[model samples]
Structures are given as C-alpha cells and as structure tokens.
Target: MRGVRVLFCYLILAGSVSAQNIESLLMAGDRSAYNEIMSALQRKDFIEAIIGLNSFIPGYSSYGDLYFIRGVARMQLNDVEGARKDFILAKASGYKEENINFFISKEYLVGRLLKDLKMEIKLDSLREYRPVIESRDTIQGALRPERTCFDVYFYNLTVKILPESKSIQGSNTIFFRTTADTRIIQIDLFPRYTITSLKRDGKDLIYTRNYGGIFIDFGEIIPAGKMEEITIEYSGIPIVAPKPPWNGGFVWEQEKKRYNVGVACEHLGASSWWPNKDHLSDKPDSMIINLQVPYGYQGISNGNLRSQTDVGSGYNNFEWFVSYPINNYNVTIYMGDFVNFSEEFTNNSGKYRIDYYVLPKNLKKAREYYTQTKDVIGIFEKAFGEYPFRTDGVGLVEAPFEGMEHQGAIAIGGEYGKSNNRRDYWTKDYDYLVIHELAHEWWGNAVAIGDMADAWINEGFGTYSEFLFAEEKFGYPEYIRVAASNFSSILNIWPIVGERNINSNTFLGGDIYNKGAAMLNNLRCIINNDSLFKRIIKDFYLKNIYRIVTTDDFIRHVRDYTNTDYTGFFNKFLYETDPPVLSCSYSIDRKNNLTFNYRWTRVGPDFSMPFCIAVNNKEYIRLNGTSFPQTFSYENVNSFFLPNEYRYEKELVPPNSFTYYWTTWPF
Candidate 1:
C-alpha cells in the first residue's frame, strides 16, 4: 500500500496531471482533501479513501490520476468490476497506458505488487481465485472405476477430413482387455459430436452420454481377462484453435488455394475430437490411422506411411500404422499439398529413415535446411542411446503454428529461423523449433509421463537436449552461455510439479522448460561426474523406452544407479517454489587473511549441495553447503568471487553449475 501511494504521488508530480488543471480544480483550498484521501490509502483505509474520492471526483472529473488511485483502492477491496471501469476511465482521461496497464494485466499486477509492495500474500492463497474444476474435467482427466476396468491395447481409426466445410466424420474401433469383471465401461468424446451407432460384434449396445463420458452397458458381465472390441461411429466439427499447440484443437487454413489441416491436443483432451479412454494412464500398444482427403493433397499421421489408395471420386485414403505404445494426445493428422523427401541416418546402432513433409513451395529450402536433423539425431543417439522408434522412421511435418511434439510426426514452425536471437551468445543459426520438437521424440514420445503433473520429465529433458546439442555442435563455451540465458527466464512462482488427477495447465509456463532444465543441470554438478551422469541418463532412457513413468520412478532409478539418495534434492527443487539461498559472510584480518562463513537458507534440514567458488580471484575450490554453517580461510587474499553472482564470466567458473540464490554480508 505504501508503494501504491508513492506511485500515485510520482504520477501527480511527473505531469500526468497538468499543474494548470490541478490549480484550477483545487483553488488553493481543496488540495488538502486530495492529500487526506492519499493519506487514507497509505494507511490501508480503502473504505475511507473511496468515500473521499467519491466526493472529490465530481469536482475534478477530468483528473485521470484520481481515477487511477480509486481503481487501486477498489481492487484492494476486491471490487474488481468497479476497478476495471475506473482503469478504463483513467486511460480514456489521458493516463499513460504503460502506467495503467500495470494494474490491468492480472499476472503482471499480482507479480509486481508481490515484489514492490512486499505484501504478505502467499501464492497458495491465490489458488482460491483459480478456475474451478468441473465434472467434465474429472471424467476426462481421472482414472475412475469405469475407466480402470479395461486396458486399451489397440485403436483402429478411420476418418474423413472435409476441410471445405471445416468438419470431420470418423469411426474408432477400440480393442481392449478387461482387467476386472464389469457390465459397463467408459469412453470419452466431446458431447457436441453425434454418436450414430455404438456396436460390439455388429450388435447395437446401450449407452448414455454425460458431458464427454460415454458409458456403455454390455447387458452381460464380461469376465476378467476377456478381450473385446467396439466401434463407435461419430461425426462433428471439431473446435477451431484460436492459437494452436497452446490452445489444443484443429487448425483449418489455406495456403493460397490448397487447404492445410492439422490437429494438436496435448493439454486439451483428445476427446475434443475423438472417442477413446482420454486419460493419460492408458496408452494403446499400437494404432492404425486411415485419413481420407482430397486426391491432390497428402494426408499424414504418426509412424510409417503404409499406402495411399484412391477410395473414390476426388478422394484418397492414406493409411498409417504405429508399432509401439503411444500417448493418446500424441496421435495426430496433417493434411496439405505436401512434397515428400527422405534420407537414411546410418549410425553405430543401425540405419533408420528420416522423412520430411513440406509445402511444395519450400521443398528446395527444406531439403537443404533439414540436413541438420541427421546430425541432431546422431548427437541424441550418442547421449541417450539410439532413437526409440527405429522401426517407424522419423517424420517432420510443416505446421501452421509454432510446434508440437506429436510422436513420430513432429510439428515444425517458426518460419525455419534461429529462435533465440535475443541473446548475443547465439553465434550459430539453427532452428530451435526443430531441435526442441525432435528432442521430444526421445523425451516426450518414447519416455512418456503417466500423469500430466510429471510433465517436467517430458519438457525438461526435451529442453536439456538443446543444451546437449549446443555442446556437441557449437562447443562447451556456447553451451554454458546458452544455459545462463535459459536460467534467467525462471519465474519460480510455482513448483515444477502440480497436483495430480486433475487436468492442470501448469506446464504451459516457462518454468517447466527453463527451471526444469536448470534443475537437471544442477543435479549434474552435484554428481560431479560427467561420464556417470551421461550413463545414468542413457540407462534411464533405455530402461523406460515406450513406457509411462512418474517423478517418483525417476527418483528411485537415480537412487539405485548412484547408490546415493537425492530425495531431498528432488523434493526441494520440484515440490517447492523457492530455490535454496546461500548465505555468506566474510571478514579480513589485520594481516589481509580472509575468513568466510557460508551456509544454505530457506531449504529443508536435509538439503546440502556443493558449489564452486574462486578464492582470492585465482584458485578454484568446491565447498559443500548445508543448513549448518561452514568456514573457509585463505591467506593474503584480495577478493572472493562466487560463480552464481558472476555467471557471464564463464572463464572464472561454469554457469549454472549449481542452483541457488546468493546473499553476502559486508566484510
């Protein structure tokens, strides 16, 4: 509240309100009234301030600063609607957009106030204002009893894309094995679609629709260990994506005259357009996708393209088959007037095919630009074992939006340019979109997460792969420089892991990508053995290929591999929002000898991490920091430099070799 009052005073004195206007309105007597209102606001007496402003506003109706102050008071009183109106009025009355927008944007307002005002507001307390989870989200995100009774093994989907009308008609034949005897089961599809028929062995079945859940009754108790199949016939217009990949839906666009169609549904449930068990826990062992599109356009999906056959007048069916277990959301389709090209990647493991699908206009550029894929793949293979889907072959499709890691058919966008030009360290030109999505082929597609809460495993590893790529392609100096740039983006407002069993959008933030990668890098510094760290990552990927895993599974694996327990490390970085703080104090004796005391703060009792420091700005030393204080003395030292503070000076120490905020007392 004091900061709010100071901002108001600055705005008034800095010409947001002209002296002529204030002088005319105040008339040398009413100035004290305005001062009283601001004093009330400074005291956190919002009600008194609002009352004073109510009387003062009618006299000086054109004063935008007055409206701005009233808006702040209204917001403090939880009158958001009234505050919004006052903010708009302030802008219309000539208040600077930059100043008013600080109160208008919710995310910026909360973050700024939390910092400048030093408010005693916990981020957890803000959860009460978050969007409430509805019944539909529960049915789609949770593994209820109805969904847990059956395990899906395969999916045979046939769909026809009518891009002219922006609609689709499809049928999915689900093959599942019953784990428990039950007379009913649940399948999910958006309620907007019409279910023409639900059948088992060509006989109609009884079912009821509730939101996205379609509960079907079989009329008889299916015995345990029984395999059954059901084909659901449905058709509808899928939701159009306002902003793709982030807003999960279908993208229907036109490249000149030809239609470009694709769908991405990572956060948005797959049930938005298809019928299946939408939860993440159940991934089909294999899949067959048949997409029928206009004869001139090519239809693409995950895995290998088996065949393209003319089905009828003006249409052709492109059949695809996936041989390994796949996440439901990773299943996708792309349709456009595309030109195809291929190359063979021969490595020590074996030979594999890499396919590129691009618009006919960019075929020549794509051929030259996409050659880097081979080198990237080779780097990943050397670091984390061979590619996971050797049999299916790798595919990259040009997408309308940024990018998405759709199993084998990765989406590539960003206009095929270097994505991180904001940092001067990027001396090489490379497509970050391609590298990031390709990395997902190993981290997200092959080694998947069972619940969205553990999305850090998918995105964190994918982002870290970029660091690995930098080390191999550009050298270690470039890698450390880029890692420093990546670490600067961490918000640390929320924990990397979120609550399970609900469809949470926490992974949409940069923390999951930046902070998660930083956490892994810190772990490497703690292990202090580069070869062993690489071995641990490679073994983890090899062991869990084509499998669903959780954060706990990774913790257990690391514990067994290194013979050292890092449970407290993971708990501090993943489950908590604040990073550990390193507290230090130093004193120089009369003889110029330096004595330093350092320890960790704002961490658990069991937390301890080793970080490097430069003594006397010359020699390097590594010290283990714990909750308890430890001291180190150096003779005739001039200065001590902590690596965490001077990260850009890479020659002195490596950047992000450890993770912590640092504070030091005067000598």
Candidate 2:
C-alpha cells in the first residue's frame, strides 16, 4: 500500500520509473560522469572538465552535482569568475538540501571572491563595483551519460592512528571499494606520522606514499558490492596535531585545562588525522571508534556509551560503536571532566532517552537551559518523521563555538552561555541555537543529503526549524520578527559552493541563516495552503528518511504532493541574482473603481515573485515579476497609499528601482 501511494505520487509529477530502470539510469549517469571527470582531473585537463561540467549543468541543474564539479574544475584551472558563475548557477538551481546551496554559495564567496589579493581586498573593503566577468574561454568537452541508480551498499575502511614523538605521530587508512579481493585499495594518511607498520584486512601489507597521503595497492580491487567492514591496527602519537579542519589530537589551553578535542574528518579535513577515502560517494554501514588516551582524561565519541577500561599504568581504552551509518567527519571525541544527565521518554515510535552531558562546572546551567528539550523533541517528532537514531539518544557535548548536530551526540558549548542575567542576555535566548542543532537530527543527521552540496537540507531547514519552534512557542508575530531579523542579516549576497570551511558556512556571515529561513517562508507562501504544505513536509520527512536527496528530489516531492508545476521556482530564487522589489499604490477613482498599481523594481538581476498586497481593508494578489506594473481595480475603496500600512516586510530589497505612483492617501 505504501509503495502504491509513493508510486501514485511519483506519477503525479515526475511520472513513475521502474525500479530497475531507475537503477540502470542512476548507475550509468554516476559512472559515466565520474569516469569523465576523474579522467580529466588525472590528465590535469581542467578546461575539458569545465566544459564537460558545463554540458552537464543544464540537465542536472536540480542536482547541484554538475555545478559543483564545474566549480572544482574552474578552481583547479584558477578561473575564479567561471567558478563563481557555475557555483551561483548551482546555488540558484536549488538542490533538495540547504547544505549544497550553502556550500556552493560559500565556494563562490570565498573561493572566487577571495581568489586573489586585490579582489579579496576590494570585497573585504566593500567596494562599490566588484568585478564579476568570466575571463576563461569556453572549452568543448565530451558529454557523459546520466545514471539513475540508487543502490544501497557499504565500503570498507581500515584506519591506524599512530603516535609520533610524545606529542604527535602519523596515521593512515586503506579504503576498499568492496570486501572481495581487498588487494587494490586506496590509502590516505598523514606523512608526519611515522608508519610503524601496515596491514590489509588484518594481514600485513606494503604501501606507497603519495603527494597528499599514502596509497595502498590492494593487489586487485574487490567487489563485495554490499555492506563491508575492514579493521586496521597501529600505534603512534598523532603527528603534528591538526588545527582548523580536522579536530583531533591535543590542545592544551592554560586556563581551560588540558582538553582532548576531536573534529575528525569534516569537510575535507579527514586526511589530517588518518589516511582514508574522504569522498562523499560511499558511506560506511557502521564504525568502531577506539581511542587509547593517556590514563587521565576520558574519551567521548558518537554513539551509545560502550565501555571504558582502565588499562592500568595511567592508560585507558575507550571503545564506541555507532551502529548507525555516519560520515567520516561526523565521528568526533571530547575528553574532559564531564557530568551527565539522562532521562527517558516514550513516543509513538518507541522508547528513547535524552542525555545532557557537560563539564561538571556547567551541569546546573546546562540543565536549566535544556529543561524544555523534551517538549522540543515532541514538537519536532510531530512535524519531521521519527528521530533517526535510538540507541545513543541525544547527547550535548561542549564546544568553543555554537552547536553542531553531531548525529546522536550534539556539540553545545559557549555558544549558548548567558551573559549578564539570563533575562537580559544578548539575543535574549541561547536555546534557539540548541533547538537549531537538535532539529538537525531529523533534517541533517537522519535524512542526510547525499553530499554537502545540499546543505540547505541540513542548515537552511535546520535554521528554519528555529523559526518554527519560535512560532510554536511565541506565536506568529514573534516568528515574523525573528524571520525579519534573520533576513536582515543577508545584506550582501555571493555564491557559496564547495567552500573550505563548513564551520564558517554553519555560522555564516550576513543573514544567511535568517534570510535562508525567509526564503523557505517565501516558498511556503507560494505553496500557500497550510494543510497541503504541512502534508508535503510530513511526506517529505517520511519518504526521505535515511536517504540523501538533492534539490531536484525535493522539488519533485513538493510538486507531486501539492499538484503544483513549480519548475520555474528554482530558476527565479536559487539560480538568479535578483530579489523582487514591490511598489504599492491604491486610490478610489471617480467611477468608484479603486485603482491599484504595484510596480516591481528588479533587485539583483530580476526575479518573478508572488506576493500579497493589502489595500483598504482587503488583500489583493500581485504577481510582481510576472508583469511590469500590474494594475488592479477595486470596485469600492476610500484611499490607499504605496503601502496601506507599515506592516509590509522589506525583505526583498530592490537594487536601483523606485516607486513614483501617486495615490490619494500619500498625496
């Protein structure tokens, strides 16, 4: 019955595809594109890669994959403008998830804008006219066939973390495509860490060092083509500790004490600690994290609390297993004096628990802040499908910055600390950030996007969830105010894709979080009916659980459920540079026909937008970009100005357009 329902919905919009056909298409598409791009990259013919990517973008605009690959190629060839254009196109295309959009936007903003010193200086200094012309010539390249397969399988990873001197050592891992053969395997590890030993599937093996890391020739490639696992063992202190990207090793702050921080391989930082395949193509079934920390400090990792054994002589061994599939980077650890609070709750799904773990000193404060977690959980479960993970529950770990939806264990730290009395604190609330991170369990952790390219599925939706929580708690007006504040933050805009820092993207500058939320609200407006929209939300969560969806996937869901043809939706908002500017005017004429002219001022480039215009106690519909200055006649009306009231949200600001329509009320 469920399958029938899903098929019916699929047929309504995109038309149903046979499972076998979809598999064949998906595999063909992925393999062909991957082979072409990889070959181009290998030959260092980034120009050809860009051309191939350009040819690919039109067909897969819904998926940011083509644009992202284009951006990578442009970056490789030092074509900043070309890269920026592709990334902006990708961002505008609107992938199913926010991560991809945000990632593309970040890449354009940082990678392109900051490509050189002069442009970087101008952008940093907020120059009046920034250059945005593509300097690279268009190159012709071969087009690859598209694949539509959606196979579920696993890859094997064997990592060995060794210690160098007392402070640091080298570590590496071998990644095998399948469980069979196990001979031709790829290895990526830190060179600083001395390779004391090497192994392949428990047997000793030899490896060759590569530029970035080490590569192990897995005699020949194996094809398990199913969930597979590989184990590796070695000993060495982490070589020259990783700082920015990878968050592992030791960082000792004099006042803060000796703390063991773990940010493992996030974004592209996995190679800093261990050698492994850091790509997003294949995800492991489950992971076993074992840390042998020096006797004193405790090791905290993701997943259920397994066990900690004191190995005696001031050494302890911590073994944790995340039965759930997680990304290479999501695996993290924090070793410090920690206090824990645990509670259980029963929901329609099943029995689950919520745990708040914090430093002993902040336990009291942590409880006070997280007191409403149970309520928050209840609210989300009703909206998004069931929480993805069960065993580990929700654990809040301390961090230096804001919060991270670190799968089962969320990292919460100083980002939520209160300043002066909690009543008069800045932002007046810290729980909002906590709520944002917690909601990610469903949006990001559970129903994760295939790649970071669709980050909006995680951050934008997660950020929007903050506003949703605000609406539920404070009411509509408060939600509007919060949304407005968030929108106000995106004063300037730039493309972001494949940018270096996920942290910077998460805590983005301007008003990305808020403005991004506003964008979703705008989307809600387009798909007005709450019942239908809410149903779409519910259905999206239910169907997309544990699956990586691209922007096209989301659009398919929305269009199918609502029976709306919104093919132009992404072209207007996600892909373009303009926001709609509204000009309002209304007046009762001699014939008692109230005249209203709502002119649209193109903001960035131009965007077709739909908005409601209220005039003289009645709301009138106005499609801003659909036509130039749309005129409306009301049968009876006294007087109305550009805007009947000051209640109009000034979110979509115009670039250089003005309003000159005369109205009786204004004159």
Candidate 3:
C-alpha cells in the first residue's frame, strides 16, 4: 500500500529513463509528499496520516493495498469502525487478508512490517511491479468456491445524484435464484452508505451486517431453483474516489461551471457506489439502470440509452438498459456537460455506430482524435470478432481521471491522443488511450475472464491490440518495432496470474499489461507460423466470446487447437516470475561442419520453446529444446545473429549480453 501513494508521486517525477526501475526514485530528491504520510504513520498520528493520504490517493482508488495502510492508521487511532470499513475496502481492492499475511498481516500495524514492505513500496511505483509471491497463511480470503447456492441474475437500479453534498441515494432490486434450499443471502454495499430499508416481495426483511456484506434472512426456506427479488434502499456519501479506476469510489469534480462526475470501481468493486453481489463470477445477463440528476447535467450508463425525461424540480431521469451480460465492476455512471455525436460502421455481422461523449470544449480535440476509432474497430474485428456490444455501440466519455475500458462506454480523461504513452517505439500519431481502451471491447467486454487473477486475459490482449493496430495500419515491421519497445517496461518481479478470485492488478503488481502482451507477441514467434498464430488468436476470442475463462482454460485451448503440448509451456510462463531462457554455444567440427548446442534454462524442467537463429547472417533455422541440450548442424556457419527474444551469455564475445532483455544471464 505504501507503494501506491508514493508510486504515483514518483511517476510524475521520474521520466521515461527511470520508468523501468523503481529504486531509482530513492536517488532523486524532494520526496516529502511520500515521506509526509510515512512520518505521520511512524509517529502514530492517524489524523495527520489520513489527511496526507487523502491527497495521495485520487485517480488511483482501485489500489486497495494503500487503503490497508490507512486501515492500520485507523486501528492505531482506535477508530475500530473506520478500520473495519477500510479493511473491507482493502479486500475489495484485492488485498484480501490471505495475500498479505506472510509479509504484512491484516491484524499487524504498519510499524511491524515496515522492514519487508520498504522494498515492496519502492518497486510498485510503476504499475509493472506487484507481489504475486504467495504467503504461507493457510487462510485464503475468498478464492474458494461460493457456499451459497444462489446465483445473481439482474440488477434494476435507481440512483439519485447529489454531488453538491458529495452523497447519493439509491435503490437496487436484486433478482436472483436459489440453486439449493436456503434462507439467507449475501449482498455488499460499502458500510458508509447506510441501508435505509430492505424488502423482499414488498415485505420488510431482517438482515445483519458483516463488514461490507449485508446478509438477509428470508425467514422461510427458498427451495432450490426458486427465483425471488429483493429491493434495498440505501443512502450516504459513498467513499469519494481518492483516485479512480485504481483507488475508485464515486467521483465528484467540477468542470465547465458544473460538476463533472463518473464512477470507476474496477478493482475497488462496484459496491463502492451501489449495492450488488460484488463478485466477478455472477455477471447479470441484463440490467436496468435509472439515474436522476440535476437538470443542467445528464447521466450516462452502460448499453443502450433508453430514455431521458423531465422529473420535475430541475431534475431528469435517464433510463439505460443493457441486454447483454456485464461485469459488475464495469457498471458505471457519468454525469456532466456532455454532447454526443456518432458515426456508423457496416460490418458483416451488422451495422453499429461509434459514439463519442465529451465536454463541449473538448469536442474539437475529441473529433480530431477519435477518427482512429473506426479503423481500430476494423483491426480488432479482423483479429478477434465483431464489436462486443453493437446495439449499445462503442462509447467514450470525458472523465476526471485518465481513462478506463468501461464495457461499451469507455472513459477518456483529458488525454485524448496525448497520454497514450507508447514511448519512442510507436512511430504513429494515434492516441494510445483510444486504441487501448477500444481493444477491451474484444478482450474484456466480449470475451471475459471470471477471476481477476487472469486479468491478463483483458489488459494483456487489450495492450497487444495496439501493436496489431500498428501492424495493420503501418506494417509488420512497425508492429515489431513498437512491440519490441514494449519490453523496456517489463518488470519480471511477479507472475502474471495472481491468486484465484483476487484482482490480478491488486497485489500481483502491474506486469499484467506489458508482460502479458510481450508473452503473447513472443508466442507468435514460438508458433513459428504467422497464419497459425493469427488463427489461434481469432479462434480463442471467438470460442470464448461472452464467456468467463481462466489462464488454464486459454492455454489448454491453444494446446488442443494447435495439436501441441503446452501444459508445461504455459505453466512456467504464467505461474513463474521468470521468462524462459536459452543457453547456447557453438563449435566448428574438424570436417568444417558447424554444430550449435543450446538448452532451455531458468524454466520448468519440461519447458520446451522454439527458437530461430541466423548463421553467418545468412540462413535461418528453427530450434526447439526442453531442459536437455539439443544440437543443430550447418556447414561453414560463422557467427550467429539471434532474434530479440533470446537471452544467452556470450562465452566468446565482449559486452557478454545482447541489447535485448534487460536481465542478464544466470537469470
């Protein structure tokens, strides 16, 4: 958690050169903002620490680990209820009690674990670093399967916005069915938002609170396969998003003489604003969202906009309906000065409009930047499938934070074409945000993963889509150059897959984006056939459309479809922190026949991957190896030129390493 507040502060301070290394920040000067809170925590000044933390967390609230640090500060101040609330927020933010146990226990104070956490803090400055290292705490937060035999179906929600007071009033009708005899149900809403009334079939129901979970008693058993509904009304100032998407909550901000607002819960969990099942596995097939906001402003939601009608007293109700299934975390609402314009694209599947919603002032910039959306949609449609929510259409809304892939309606902070940081590798003019966020329509929206642990399924593919777009728009060479540039951001500190049921971005560090994409790009080389690789990519997305899958589910598909054994291949890459390595040597036999020997090292014992090498900078050959050494023959072969993917020590050359992978041999 200390990594979070301090991380963002240093990110602004450190430029491209320092982006890859977190420890470099320590060598820089004037880190008072980060130290301010640390000193407050060390002095047991909870109020001062809270005040300092307030400034550090905006725009990154989904970062739950930081909230845990605040929880510790709360505990020291004897604010038991506050600490309890922060702990629940932490769990939702992905810092489940189990994951933090070995190094930092849930019950332990900041002072106790400061020694081990220092390195964790220093490394997490870049989104690329997080701890996938497992703890020995036999307890595993909520990774286990659900005990309740009930499944959520739909959420009919009513939200009344009161941004002036920084609070909201809401009612949610939860439609669910029981799979087994049961009298109890669990739903979550942040504790700060008090439950005003609870009813089932118009009858008041008795319920009890357990942190963020609100357990209701049905009084009589609801038989297996029974369908019922519960309507709960709650009102309070929801946790104001200190930061969004990352440290998410309800966001309230002022722009253009009125409040510009949006909700970004992502890892923070939807319960931060509205009440629901609050888990990834149970996405509702459809939803009805009704929003009432001040008359001068408008509210936007997921899926299709159904209606906007006057509701008296300078307020209007906007009803939105989503017929397709949606992740609860993707549920959102943005209200403010927004104007809409749309362009239609006719694809083989159907015709859908590409929609844009931005502030009046940003309309010029948005128009100029968003012209790339149509081409981007084409690239993904060619690669994966069609747009995910065509009827709802593709959406872009101006938000206070940078941006988020919010299902159909994406959020664009202020950076239209600018903040899309591709570094010097991308030789194009398109903004990174639009391309990256729209790609989610395929990876995250259309084909979804159940557990946050497999989030690479979303972030990784979404990221690689940029390279593919470059290849499609520019050429294959440009794609390679940009894709190669991706390696500079890679931090192999943690595995891409996190613990089951946890948000992969939470504690696993941030490689889910860069590392995940790099692995996929490298996999293209390993498959050794561009046609087959493209087919695999397209097939994986098409088959898993509107589905929830895991890393194993994907790897198995790749292996079974290709008629190759990738069980160990994927296990090492997905579960291990280090990437596969190759150790090599060459000798010229007396007969003038050159023999090359290579072994796969720093990988699973059964690891085997393909490699391409050019001899005398002339002919190229593909080589494969497991843990054992393998040899290749080419007569009169001189020096070798390896592709950028290889990692080997130079037994006979200076520099001892290629200009490729940052990590050296003995990896």
**Residue by residue across 1-667, what tens digits does model 2's lDDT show?**
0000011110121111111122233445566875676577555455456556566556555655456556545533333345456567756655232333332343444433233211222222242222321211000000111001112133233232222234433233333334343444444444545566676556766667644334455465444453333333333455332432222333332235455354433433344455445434345566666655666566667777677887665667677777787755566666666677888867976888787777776778777877767777877887776677787677777654335567777767552457423321124444665677788788867777655445555666777777677667766545555554454334234322212212223222323344445566667666656567667877887897766676678878887887776665554444443344454555667867777676545433333455554345334334444436678777756543232112233333221111111111111
Say which candidate scores most in lDDT: 1
In model 3, the runs with Cα more than 4 Å from the true position are 1-148, 419-425, 502-508, 585-597, 612-625, 631-667
Across 1-667, the per-residue lDDT of candidate 1 in tens digits comes to: 0001122222232234222244455757788998888777765555567779898988878877778777766654434456667888888888764656654554654445444433333343366222356676677777778888999999999989988889899999999999999999999999989999899999999999988999999999998899999999999999887557765689987857889889978878888888988888889999999999988899999998899999997889999999998888889999998888999988777798999999887788777778778888888988898888889989999887668988888887644553434122464446666777888888988899877788888888887888888888887666766676666555455688866777765554456787788888888878878888888888989999888889998899888988998888898889987677677767768887988898887777877888766666556577778889999888887755555422335555543354434343321
lDDT of each residue in 1-667, candidate 3, tens digit only: 1012112211121122122222234323435665777676654444567667676755347766557666655544333345557667767777654433322222232222223323222223333334333321111124322225688889999998988798899999999888788877778787888899999878899988766667788888888898889999999987776655556677788855688888887766788789888777778888999989998887988888899999888889999998888988888899988899889988987798777888897789788877777888888888887887888888888887757888778888755655544222464456667788888878887788777788877888887888788888887656765565555455455677876643444323346777788778767766667788888889988888878877888888888778888667667667876676566666666766787777776666766666555555445555666679788888876555454422122222121111222111110
Q: Which pairs of residues collide in model 1?
A: none
lDDT per model vs. reference: 0.76, 0.50, 0.68
Q: 431, model 3: CA deviation in Å?
A: 2.2
- Put the candidates in lDDT order, highest first: 1, 3, 2
lDDT of 2 at 648: 34
Ranking by TM-score: 1, 3, 2
